[model samples]
Target: MRKVVGIFFLLFSLSGVTEVKDAHSASHTSVLLQSAYESVEPGRSFNIAFTITPKEGWYTYWENPGDSGAKNIFEWTVPEGVTVSAAAYEAPKRIPYTGLMTYGYKRPSTVLFTVDIMSNYTAKSLPISLEAEWLVCEEECIPQYGSFKLNIPVEKAIPNEAAADTIASFSTHQPEISWWDSRLIINDTSSALTIEMSEEEIKDYTEAYFFPKEDGVFTYSAPQTVVGMAEGLVLNAERSNSLNKPEQVTGILFLKTAKGDHQYFYLAPTLETPTIPKLSQMEDPIEMQSFPLWQALLFAFLGGALLNLMPCVFPVLSLKAFAFVSAGSLSKADRHKEGWAYTSGILASFLAIAVVLIALRSGGDALGWGFQLQEPRFVGLMVIILTLVAMSLAGIFNIQTGFEGAGQTLTQKSGAKGAFFTGVLATLVATPCTVPLMAPAIGYALTQDSITLTITLMMLGLGLASPFLLLSYSDTLASKMPRPGPWMEKVKQGLSFPMILTALWLATVYGDQTGQLVHLFAFVTFVAFLIWLREQMSSPLKRILILGVTLAFSAWFLGVSEKAPDRALSDQPSTSNVWTEQAVSNLRAEGKPVFVYFTADWCITCKVNEKVALQRTETEDMFKRNAIVVLKSDETAGFTPDTLKVLKKYGRAGIPLYLYYPKDGSEARLLPSVITIDILKEYIEGKGV
Candidate 1:
């Protein structure tokens, strides 16, 4: 599919039927832009191209010219209506010319310049002169100048397909999204955009360019991109070493995707978050600290509705629907009653969760809506329930006699009970989804009185229950259900698939929270119990006995395991390199300048900065030459007390932290949350003595 899409666009480029005329050439070039000038209309822009056919050994500078280099600049001379603007530069690679460097194309190239027209005007042709200066070097730097006149008929409007496809093609080569790692994630709290690129793809590539779409979000020249991770060419880009989290980070990423003659743009990241802005007396920036009440309510409602579709909630919903349909021929009133009961169940559960969250918030428990699942016991309980569903479907256990099998029929009355239980199950599943979104809402609610918070929670509950309510009320929907028949038996059996799937999924969650080995043991034991339950039922009591034993074993496993510590190293990879207390202590003992990165895989911002700017050559060399002992500690899988103490020392509640220690080891200098190569170098070279 991707190949087909790429080819379709490639063909469009070949079909742009435009003619070219005047062609100029330099001493070292074979071909140049023939008729590259286009007239700009009032309030419109013209994307003019300057193509170069180099004779080899000649190149251009990217936006940044590195430590010592020059970038290509276009001196445009046009009518007042035509304002020349650089089409955001497709970043260039660093060409080390002698001891100096430059950023631009070395082979045949096209530089796109967007010219803006202030007002509408008419002309036979728009004439413009180009004074282009570039440092073309082989051994000695050669400064070159070009003077050319371009006269092209100005059409009333830019051609649609011709111009649209042209620009779109340029965009295809840009990075679509900026991410820290495999999963695409970008965040505002962090200062720099982190991007992880493949080593093979960037093997000959040596620079990172950030083209910001918004100002006030980031400061230019504060930092440069650096290489953080080296796993298969994975690297982290942080804000300059000095700045931590910027108010906002927004930009496009242009990395080297090919070698030699042909190279181009790969990604464009567009979205800027605000930093602390000066807004007189009444304006507060949008931070986790200052989420607005209306925004919170809106997010809560939307998030609540989305909760109905989460995988964890599906089983309960299925169980509910099965019960709802089984209620036999019901009067419209009874059906209405059942719908209200289900809604009540959902609302009650949400309110209960909200109460718990409020209490925990007061007690300072760091508790969120899904906080219960953080307890291994709760997760273990879910595992047992899933296992039971699986067993029942296979007809291995006589348990849950109300339902024939994992997906079997339920007695009409029992089915109604199932519907109620499902409501509860759904409430549990909805917690994780709601917490993150709710955090902002609740945090904002905290500024209001308790009544407002309660109302917010209520609104959230209403949204969550809306879908199930819709399913209940309409007779048409109920009638559309497959009539009670033998096929339900097969359908019931199919339900077991989801049950087993849930068990597996819950196991993964447990594993992530605890350890994989522990979950594996539980999975093995559950499977064994199922096997034993089959083929060994003598009487009802004996069957009950088997169930008891299974439950006891599961309970014992839960009892033996401790809730994984809050700071347990996370299963998710670190966004930055790991920094441990032991390593820091050792470094302090050795009197070496140490840079510590405390991060977790769960942190989206952490990952973004890692990929975009961290993984560059200059940053790597900076670390190496400075003898900067790099240490990292991840809290995703879990963290230890010592690590917690370290985190507290840095005054951070989460990951993606940077600390710089001087050789003298007075007090570690807390670097900004965002980082880059230049910042790291300055810290080490300027402060490390």
Candidate 2:
């Protein structure tokens, strides 16, 4: 911690002098090379970013510069043994000039690439030489071209915080993703190339535009309708303006999120239909689904209301309870104001998560609710957060909002902010668990229009916040609270137990996600040592040293750890069969009823339903009596693309998906997300409740 604080302060000292030199040709547009690190470490991979900023009203084109602008071209002259990757193009913002609509940046944007250094190169100074050219236009196009150089002294220096901040700001130009899918509709008259994905993928934008990779394939300025479909969302693009079509269409789809977050999608749709082996997928592609908006709203509200009871949310409930109890001295109006603020914070967080979800999903990233929990890195971070929160609650730290120390009194405004922060924390912790009511609503929200999605999420937030809001505004509830004193301190300290438990749980989850008990537990021990070291230290220097080492170690570990080895299906129920379409086919050929379960270790609901339904003796007997075959797939520690493909085939984004296939050769039935023993029995009986 002491070392970390020292480095932080050192970086802060350098912030003023971190010079960035821009290479400009006549000032219409400027290009700059900025190092994201203080020094280029030997044999380490780091980023050297290119920032393209156009003067007011002028713009530079993207790689696929729409109808006519020239794409930016860059060449580098580097020392031998150095490997530089191709540029990671930032999503281009729309640049409309004259009568033509072009694609590129009108403001500042960045393109980053990784530079790998060779171990053999031990030089003190390494020169970075580069030449770049691009077409910039306001009314008329100007071909701006230039050469630039930077001499980077090789050293084992830390990351540059200022350059990092700049990189981060420019990095938003990176694309947000959703799953990638091309839905082709074949009819007698003509075939339409439809791209179907989650509506949340592009829900933020009011306009839909496509820039084809191959020229003459798509009409550059032609309008495309972004509509919500049953499968999720689709961009029904207009054909070429010249009535000409390419054999295949491929390019980038750009959308500015409701929050002004730019997202890009690299769409490459095959001219023909796709085939997934071992799966008989959904057949229809063009019949766009129009789910009624009212049903989604109702489900969303119900799901949010039930979210409070989830394990992911329970640990944070104490904080909201404490906030409510702490509000005893405040007047009714003040309490009401705090409640509104708290509610707003939750709604804001949900909205932000929605925007992020849409962006990433649109970018072809396989993401969903509880996705962070699926990541070992995220689980590790949660461990750190819970540990610090435990320490704060146990009186180890006097954390405050804009206040100096314990001697200072907190104003009502700060108190309200704390309440708001607690609400935010509650929503964050609640994300990992798909409780009974929330699964449908969360699933539904991802498919709706932005307004509907936001409204749906707001309903969810209201449900989560409603109970506390009621308490916040209630004078009667406040009257029931014991006064804040020594007991309050004791209660706060006691609250630390749950936080520690949560930290432990998160640590265990990290192990589960990685399937490396040794490494994860060792990592946890290191973190524990740091926490203990902080408590034992009176000298601030020693504390920072431990904190810095721990953090740096964590950063290094997450950066280079190999993927976790695959987990076997040995722990599955003895009666449960291994899941495979071939197995199902064989069983059905033999006239046996089959029940298929799709699950993952990261899914808490999967474990619960596994214990409550499939593992039950009565359920087993019912299955046996009906001669049923139970098949389960555990997609926990490795890349099981087949599992993911099967999941997608079932119209599911993630796990705990249950399907019942009767031997009668009837259509398969989808079991509810939260299935009861009775429901499972009815499903086996071929009559769903």
- Model 1 lDDT per residue over 352-430, tens place: 8667767765785443234565566676677777677666655555545344422244444544455555666677655
- Backbone clashes under 3 angstroms, per model: 73, 25
**Once superposed on the true structure, which residue ranges of model 2 sit more than 4 Å away at CA?**
1-289, 394-414, 448-459, 535-550, 560-562, 567-576, 638-653, 686-689
lDDT (10s digit) by residue, model 2, range 654-682: 56778887676433566676777888866
Best by TM-score: 2
Question: What TM-score fits each model?
Answer: 0.43, 0.53
Q: Poorest 10 consecutive residues of model 2 by lDDT?
A: 401-410
* TM-score quality measure for candidate 2: 0.53
